[model samples]
Target: MISQTLTLELKQVLGALLFGSRRPISVADMRRVLLEVAEQNGDVGGRFAQTSA
Candidate 1:
């Protein structure tokens, strides 16, 4: 389960990505970037598994 603080941080990061994008953001693109960020942070313990369409 994602902690509230982490969830907020993720939201902020994704929001920034969306805000800065020049084109529509696809789920695949967001998932890929989120996975990469999770991996870099060593926190990818299925936190994103429920994000599937």
Candidate 2:
């Protein structure tokens, strides 16, 4: 399981990415961004499961 703090951090990142955007964000796009962040943080394996849903 991922930590609540990490989840909140990801939410913040997502919010930043979506803020002031003209186009609507898709699930795939969010997943991709999250996966990138997870990979960068060395939590890709653990985070992947959550993203699948």
lDDT of each: 0.69, 0.67
Of the candidates shown, which would achieve the greatest TM-score relative to the real structure?
1
Worst 10 residues of 2 by lDDT: 44-53
- RMSD each, Å: 6.1, 6.5
What is candidate 1's lDDT per residue for 1-53, written digit by digit as tens?
87564443667768978999999999889888777666666654346534554
Cα lDDT of model 2 by residue, 1-53, tens digit: 87565343655767877995589988788788777776667753346436663
Q: Which structure among the candidates has the greatest lDDT? A: 1
Superposition-based RMSD of candidate 1 using all C-alpha atoms, in angstroms: 6.1
Residue pairs that clash (backbone atoms under 3 angstroms), model 2: none
Return the TM-score for each candidate structure. Answer: 0.61, 0.55
Question: Can you tell me which runs of candidate 2 are displaced by over 4 Å?
Answer: 1-8, 20-22, 43-49
Position 14, candidate 2: lDDT? 72
